[model samples]
Target: MCIYNNADPNSGIQSGGVYWAYGPHNLSNQFGNHFVMNNQYDGAWVELCTGYNGTGKGESIISAGYGFVEDLSPINSIALGTGNNYPCSPP
Candidate 1:
């Protein structure tokens, strides 16, 4: 279990100081991804995306109140409070 801070748009692939938890060194592992809801913002959503900076179509959005415990081996990046960007809401 790892905790990633808020991601910075400037950092691109290396955003959020989360590299240590989700960096290239650890991303290749076949471990399943898990995310817990720690955000206080109402209606906030966490997203697991295939691209950096939380931009792309193949994104899995986790709602503000839910947690993710799935095989996210294919995802490379994550973000919080990015629900407005994606057309589909978190499932």
Candidate 2:
């Protein structure tokens, strides 16, 4: 996943990667709407969480090959995986 500091998605400071998984990957001090690029392959997906370490409520699901400009203010973490059992929100 590539997170952009700008909402335009076309250009901005880009960060993040495909290596992070089952993480609380806390976005400290990050605010406003940003562009998130989900580059995961093989049907893998990403989940945005409200709490740290894959806890709390699940916010949104970013499927592979999809990208969106989302508000990062309420999102505290992210989880990457495939299948029904999500690492951020179980069951």
Candidate 3:
């Protein structure tokens, strides 16, 4: 149940950069990944994430645009959903 909205410039996301979310599902304990709309635009910037997918509200920049995403990381973790936990990083 991870979703992102890029309607506002104050969304804290990189103006035109792609966003990615990685984490485990609440009840299923499944891992998943989410990428923002990969549209072509000038002066695009993207923000990196940890727990939940979707760029947060702060520190944005022009999107440089990344292409062809393929990762096997989630295959070993859990899928993402509304019950996902942000900041999944271990301290």
lDDT (0 to 1) per candidate: 0.44, 0.74, 0.29
Lowest-scoring 10 consecutive residues by lDDT in candidate 3? 53-62
Per-residue error (Å), model 2, residue 45 = 0.5
In angstroms, the error of model 2 at 6 is 1.5
Candidate 3 lDDT by residue in tens digits, 25-65? 22122223323333334433333232343323221111334
Which candidate number maximizes TM-score? Answer: 2
Question: TM-score order of candidates, best first?
Answer: 2, 1, 3
Count backbone overlaps in model 2.
0
Against the hidden true structure, what lDDT does model 1 obtain? 0.44
RMSD, every candidate, angstroms: 9.3, 2.5, 12.9
Of 1 and 3, which scores higher on lDDT? 1
Give the per-residue lDDT digits (tens) of candidate 2, residues 1-91: 7788678877765544334564446666657888887887888888888888767888888999899988889888777778777766642
Pitting candidate 1 against candidate 3, the one with the higher TM-score is: 1
lDDT of 1 at 75: 62
